[model samples]
Target: MFTATPSHNGYSKTQSLLHESFWLDNPERPSAKSPVNQDIEVDLVVIGAGFTGLWSALEAAIENPNWKIVVLEGDRIACGATGRNGGFVSASLTHGFSNGLSRWPEEMTELLRMGSQNLEEMGDRISQLDIKCDWLVSGEIDVATQEYQADELQQVHSEMNKLGVSAQYFTAEEIRARIDSPIYQGALFDPQVAVVDPARLAWGLARELERMGVKIFEHSKVIELQDSGTLVRAKVGAHWVSGRLVVLATNAYPPLLKRLKHLIVPVYDYVLVTEPLTSEQRKSIGWLNREGVGDSGNQFHYYRITEDGRILFGGYDAHYHGKAGVKPEFDTDPDSFARLADHFVQTFPQLAEVNFTHGWGGAIDTCSRFSAFWGKAHGGKTVYVAGFTGLGVGASRFAALTSLDLLQGRETPRTKLRMVRTKPLPFPPEPFRSWVIAWTTKSLQKADRENGKRNLWLRLLDSLGLGFDS
Candidate 1:
């Protein structure tokens, strides 16, 4: 009945087999995690062990070690998108200034600026902590895939220049010189972006939090919440624990949070990692293998080269998902990646037989404006943050702080942002949802091919079918 069916390794994601191919699967969680044990009480309980949860625990710990901080995770720490992301520590947020301004006023302008700065600060923290996350001080190429996209990006260019964010607009030849890909007319290269091993960094932070005396429990899938006379209680299996406050950091897994379920529409995004490329292969593409890259297709596609010379390409433009269900192709599901792979190979013909050795998918929580949703709740104790729209890697830290602000009832950098709450498309489950998502996939793909961007009315129709139901 749920949509967690595994998209890789012939397992279902909803079956609790989410750990095997996840980044944490490759390397052990930074700290040894104890399985859920007897009922335990703490001053604060943080749900989810991803970046936000880990940071929450860490911040709480620093704020007051005396206050017992309990971190609960459904899976291993960093097992979710925290470890599975493109690892672009974008000094800026996912939503550009213009995008934010359109949805919100200057409230998010300085706040988002702070978020960008926070990403850089996190990098410094990693370096200070000496976490070997394979971080690289590189830029990003936000390529424009269509004429309309190019036009919008031109506005982005002008805005970036006005804001002193330091971005460059490359010509088709300029981009082609950087990489063998010829699919983009131009790109926005920003120096503030950096690439890192996401899983490693997240895991490292988890371990760091543990060393800081934070209590982390895995297999502690919190199934319910309770409001005690004096504290909030979260249920795990047969036990219930009480805490003064609770933090919900579940991003794409918002469904488990019950109240936040309707606030997020879980959509799956697929990723394919290519086998290690040879020197000839790498140099032939001239990707420098250093920059984080993504295109401006209507559905949006993001890609980057890994530390091992492999390419990680993934996006959410094609998955066939429902409000509460999912239907995917077993092999080269939906035929989007295969086509994308073919396009990649053609762009750089030096790599032959380029089969994706590892392909995986995950859920992303997208709101109407694709802006993050962060706030405090449950009588100023249950703080929560989610809705990154595939761009949470860097901002998650700030988002956590935002959640904390809500929890503490204090002014924070997070409260300065605002995103429109979009009601999810009201479509009953089943064949219709699958059909709509399938149709959306086709229409978007076609639009991408025909114009590198979707038609406006087509976007309206697609958006109509997307978003969380309030």
Candidate 2:
């Protein structure tokens, strides 16, 4: 069911697209603040002003009102994956229920409870702070594009219900009545997900942090971290911010800690946002509820309707550029955009005339386990977190809180979980790393084409707990 080559219509629709994220393309975006010019001392220093960093600062300031907190960002706030995501705020901290069930079935119940609590607290904080980010609590539907996938989704649905999770399994005819997609064989709908303007959420958190007396510096990248006596010194340009504790929230970017260099690989994902749909075009799709939709595949697509009725379609091709790392030039991939455009048209033939106005790509910090891992450096004075894969929007707050718990040496419920106590199996070093990822990608694509049958390579990875079930 995949389009082998993009047609002329697909290519033409994206010919004049803007290479920027639709969420960040806002006129009301705040201007960048001045970077650190001189040495400063603070109680807590959080690096990177994305969702994780902002949430860390906010929570820290709330817990200790008098503590001096400083946030350092390399660019404007939320310019990285934080700004370039599909904005699905899921409650599953372990990527999804099945992934968590597979990896740590013993603590899956606690993990689910903690994830749900984290999401509720986040929503409460957003309401308490009055952060306007087009927050919508319209749940998510994982649709099966193939018949085998439907059977798999049904199994997942049954398992979820047994765990006291609320879910609805939709048949082909039942789902088509709701979403009007031709390829949906069946679907599993989880009513615990939400969507937001992610960039705006980050910005609003930054605004609230500043209002709470947290000092923030934009365009200041932390190049080095050193242990200076009892305090950790973060070098931003020529200036140093010395702090009693530091939180590393730099997800997907090159890490300041050397050990992290092998624990994560920045894999690029692309997205396309179409212009707002007219009334006639809107009626053609019949997506009145505007729920976030994702296909059930190893390689899949996630699409949703924006506030203004535009469709934000992303995922499918996860590109790893060997060791080029994260760079501005890799933000645009024409082939990925064309493929997405073709897939979009195929999914909604009535929207064949729709044109995309924005196209972008950003890297996701992929780990072997496809979830986050936490560690401390400089003898537990500095705590760091990465590897949220692509589902960090809501989990970032939990990560922030847990990192704080570690920095303060507190034995909270969040710290005792096996998922928190253990780390993912490190990825193989360079050359071989590239070879492994390439082969994995090829095998995943092959499986998608062959009725979800895993070959030896994928099965081996699955046995090793690295194969992503989607």
Candidate 3:
């Protein structure tokens, strides 16, 4: 919707950027787990081995050591959004404070507390399990490149202070001192966020689950799930596996359940990673803390320094293909990569010589509310969680635990929350879905360009509490 023709000259020099994730391109990636070979029965069966599935398996295994857990993956672990994200582990379970406040004003305090606890527990797990995934609690800084955004950040800073959340507002000069980006007008720093090597985190979780005696099968796609009397039968290739309980952790893919089609849409998000910065190059940009940086725009860009000093820049253009399905070919979009590269140079003119070494894209499970929702099927024997939008790196753990609670019929603090008890407005089918998405995308783009002024269509969507984002 926000179309910007990229300059062919700058991108031409980096035409052959690798199509793999920088976090996943390591030589230490774990070998694939064996696929399901024969009929099997387990206490619990988990589908889709991303963060949600891995965390669900890990939590279930820890809760009941004797419960035989089996995880099925269509491909290798972390090969989806788990591997191809900007890796900003955030504690905001409702996407962000503003979104949380707007959606659940009454339960925001509890949600915030739970989100913070989730992040703390994640840190504890990483330490306790010795998962060396470059877990840096470096926090995040949201910068404003426009005057209107700067005013908005100031208001957000005040609101956060009132809400008892620790935050700091930086002036243009102050923010430029922290990260020498010429485009920065102001910034808000939140200390509860972290950046990590996402692929390593996924791999560590998989290894720990295996250590806990959970059997994980790679290349074993669950073609069909039939709800039998007391068990759910899943067809995986030539094998049929039955389980007492099933968890559907598949996000943004062609779901095994038809109900999920209306609740989730695969919005492709693009990213580009620059080669590791030299000492002098890093010094030039004064990012001493290496906190994750995101622009304050409807169409925003999230950039961060990887553990290896490379800058992973992503976001802005969320592409939705017709039919809204995730495919391998959608992972690399030349135009999106070029636009990102161009923006990177605009943000930091001093780094114009730095060429991107990797460019890739991943599908985000976007819902109307821009947060996750939970549901059950097959008479409560099966549970599913999806629509993480774009902030599931940390919240997936919470979703996993909550899904487990739902499947086991346990009432906990997380399960009692209204956010979990409700579902987002389902998207209409087919042509209407595509038209609404395109119109909303265009409106969001217009808002960003017009000093954040919402159009009538966006206002109507806001009134109805229905909108789309990635």
Candidate 4:
């Protein structure tokens, strides 16, 4: 392989917080994740070195102090979406209760309630562990750029009341008072969310897990999983790690299991951080408090304020890599980076023409349901978690706990959301993939527009499953 060009789809170290100005940087005191070739064995082998694997290893080791747990990473620590994300601790409620109830056959409301609880627990964990990832507890504002979105919010709000969910709805006047923008028709604010320095959180957890006795191997990629009872043989650079239990935490990488190949769609989410704004400029935007936000359309933008004065913003990008994933785009590519920066400036007139200091992208696993899919692999010996559906921050937090619960032979809240399974997106690879991805993306976008409009005709499309998934 051409290692000379570097891992073509790898993280751009140059654009990381490690190199960002004004503003960049602690991880959770993680052990150095750059360890070289080595062989080691443990009771559990966790694959994919990101938030899920880190937390899984940490929790398992903490529960059984004597058991050896190892985390296998294909690339550097936090190099995945954990390091390159928009940093929002988003909840599963974003898909709305109606969609959840319709798509997920059982306990949709409870699933969302538990989803909120997960965010609360994450807040408590960060506070108790004192893992400083610039944790900011704030509301996430979903604004309607067009009249259609405003209607969708109203309908969702009505549904929330039906479900007895607690949320605050705002009028266009209220939105304007908070931020000077006419583009927004109305907004919904969910307080059960926040932003975090994801890399710092991952690193800190990894370090803590190692200290708690988990044996972590850096260049370790689980090449294959053996189905001999609970025993699994995983491969590293020069090691074959055999363990009593194998937890496949690989979210968006080439799947370790064949059944999962087309199950997870690798959507490329991109992010860009701006150079710190002047104090006055920060106040001018009125988001000076650093609340995270995402738009209310089918395709929307997400933005958050860094601890410093800079704003990080990003959203949908073309993924060209594989069946469900985007092909890798370079960090310095003007097409990708500049396009994102342009969106940021256009969204906020006050910060027009601001230069972005960093740009990066990473693949995230999504299913047709826009939710996670997890269950047994290899006749129940190997367990896995995947299909985060673009809200991995909070979902990953819950995934760790679920993985442990299943390992301990107990039931999890996922049992409530279990009806959500990984189904093919109406086609196979090749032509099927291209059409499905494009049509689904387009259909969802149009459906979102219709919901935003509250147009009867648009609602008809959604009901017919004409534009979006049922």
Candidate 5:
């Protein structure tokens, strides 16, 4: 297992860094829209301007061109997890093939098809709309660093083959020949992943939504939602936006609904991006295809190459601050940055001298099921979805479509799936929540060290189909 010690070889490289999401640090980022200043009435009111909210508004606008849609965001567009991710838009609605198969075996085949189609449509939408956010169908490689992980990945490859999923299993030498990482014991390559400039994608979506006549208001946080006869009214500070239907796409932030409080917990994930690699530096790693890469560990690291030749490294530490909630103060973690830098060097010692330029963190809306779930409230006038668990980039579009189906009372293939119909097991409230998370995290780390052997705690979680991840 990779060491989490802060004093490792690459610690000092994290000293000088821009503490912000690399995707959001762009001169081309669109300016914020006006905030809601007065009571407004619309056919639909979508809360949150992240990918889900934007996609909700976009899809709704495309389906009903005459309907008036308003989007309210607490901060700038994509300022939340939408802009703060590794940008690996995977075609996996259920996190991954294994997780989906384990949780919803009966619907796994259909789910896989839908997820792939969703990704294809998403790419088509981006292309047709001319939204240039570096959309690359570069695929993703899940590398096994340990011998046991290699065996497990090989087993997964065989299962995927039986399921008719197109994937390639590579031996250590074969995998290393592609990426040139010494620790790669084996790899499973899934050609259904894409990487993008996530913040750019969100901004472009917002732009197109506005072009389609969707009213978006940034810095307008919906504090309260109430049922008023037929319409649902959401309070945004001193203002209110009432609509016949309301869609809550507020991921990771405090849910407007009371039941969502225990259903999802905000788990923080950190990231670091290096300065653009020199030609020589890039050649040393031999990652020419720019496929997104992740290690096969309970506490794994996902790293990908940027368009400009830099590497974005993240994952490993899924930190939960209990009842602290989501705060800006938690955006930068020194220990996490140090550990990531150390691991970055450990993975590619040939690029040990590469200096990181950016470091940031964002909270993931983690549920026990480790995938997205939907719910309805306010007498079915409002529908909400959350718990993408860090794989929401591509899934958010599918989530938006599913949420819309639920909101509009449509019985589509998406809404009929058990994965969409069922909600994850609610976490035990408060203090126990913290205790359970701490214990689970410790056990996961121990499993990583012990060749992926599950302890009693993890075994029980597996039995219940409930666990935590980032």
Candidate 6:
């Protein structure tokens, strides 16, 4: 096993990098659409123009070509979590097999099938639409950094084989040959996950929606949502727009529905992107396939190489503000960035002179179960999907389909799954919620340092099917 001395020092080189997301800083980003300025009516009005909402509008429009669809975004398209993530697109709808088996053992088989189909269909859609978003289906490697984590991965590999899932277990030497990271003790490689340019994907989808005659409005925040019996009315500034049906894809932000406040909390996740490596620097580390990599720990780190050869490293400190609100001020955390920089150097010491070009953070819609859940409000006319935790890049497409199924009152195979029908356990209110999260974070850090041994509080939470994670 590899070990290193931990330090709390900050990297002065990171101070010169841009604070914006590297993906969203592209010059190809489309111009924003005009805000909703006049009273309008449509067959469907989708809220929050992130991946989920955009997919919902596209799916619904294709299902019924004559229907008029309108999408309202509080900010520009792809400005939220969709634009600020590590961009690892996973094929697991329940986060991963372990979480799925632990939570929904009976329905895991079908859920896995659907999740695979969703990913395949996503690839097809990208090709058919001809969207050039640096799409790569190179898969992912979950590296074990500790002895206990290696043991856990070995067990997981065995279980996955029994379940007929495609996976390969790599020894420490084997893993080092692939990534050349001293921190890896071993690795579990799954060939289903993909990494993409998330902002480009979101922007490309928005363009497709426009091409299909769907109306999109940006910079139009919905101040209030009311049911008018005949339709749902949304108040956007001086405009009052009504729709026969509505879908809420607003994750992490303050939900229009009060009940969602208890179900979703905005956990801030930070990320750093290095400048493109020189040929010599790249040869020093052998990442031949450029597969996305993540360390196996309670507080893990995920890193992937962008199409431009920059390394996007993120995760490890999931912070929950006291009040749990999403704001611009939370987008930049110097302390978290410094911690990530220190960890990066520890993993790849040969790249000690490398410098990051971008650093940023975003709010993930975290729930107790750490997966997406479904709900409907306004007497079932308004369907909402939230609580994607941190793995929403690919799962958001599945969530979009489920939200449409809920809206149309269709009982398809997806809507019939227990994972789709059930809601995560609500978090406690205020000070108690903060205290529990704080205590859980401390316990998780302790477990990571203590050979993955669960303490009393963590054991109790695991027994009760309740805990906090990102």
As for lDDT, the candidate ahead, 2 or 4, is: 2
What lDDT does each candidate get?
0.67, 0.92, 0.93, 0.67, 0.94, 0.91
Off by over 4 Å in 1: 1-22, 25-32, 254-257, 323-337, 419-443, 452-470
For residues 161-217, write the lDDT of model 2, one tens digit per residue. Answer: 999999999999999999888988999999889999998888899889989999899
lDDT of 4: 0.67
Worst ten in a row by lDDT for model 4: 1-10
Q: What would the per-residue lDDT of candidate 4 be over residues 1-470, giving only the tens digit for each residue?
A: 00112221222322233222122233333455565366666688888778888878877776788887777787667777677777888766424455566765357777777888888888888888778788888878888777767777888788777877776788988887787565777988877678888888877787687667676667655676666665777776566777777789878778878878766666666677777888777777776456788886556678888877788877745453544344444323444555565555556768774666676666777655555656776665577887666777777877887777766666655544554333424225667666656765655555554453335544554565333221
TM-score of each: 0.85, 0.99, 0.99, 0.86, 0.99, 0.98
Judged by lDDT, which candidate is best? 5
What range of 10 consecutive residues in model 3 has the weakest lDDT sum? 1-10
The runs of at least 3 residues in candidate 3 whose Cα sits more than 4 Å from the true structure, single-residue gaps closed, are 1-3
Question: Candidate 5, residues 54-87: lDDT per residue as tens digits?
Answer: 9999999999999999999999999999999999
Candidate 6 or 5, higher TM-score: 5
lDDT agreement of model 1 with the native: 0.67
Query: How well is each residue in 75-118 modelled by candidate 1, as lDDT tens digits?
Result: 77776777667777776554555555554555555755785678
Query: In model 5, where is the ten-residue run with the lowest total lDDT?
Result: 3-12
What is the TM-score of candidate 3?
0.99
What does the lDDT read for residue 53 in candidate 3?
98
Error of 5 at 459 (Å): 0.5
Ranked by TM-score, top first:
5, 2, 3, 6, 4, 1
Per-residue lDDT of candidate 3, residues 182-256 (tens digit):
889999999999899999999999999989989999999999999989999999998899999999999999999
Question: Model 6, 363-455: lDDT tens per residue?
Answer: 999999999999998888899999989999999999999999899899999999999889989999998999999999999988888999999
Q: What's the residue-level lDDT of 299 in candidate 5?
A: 94
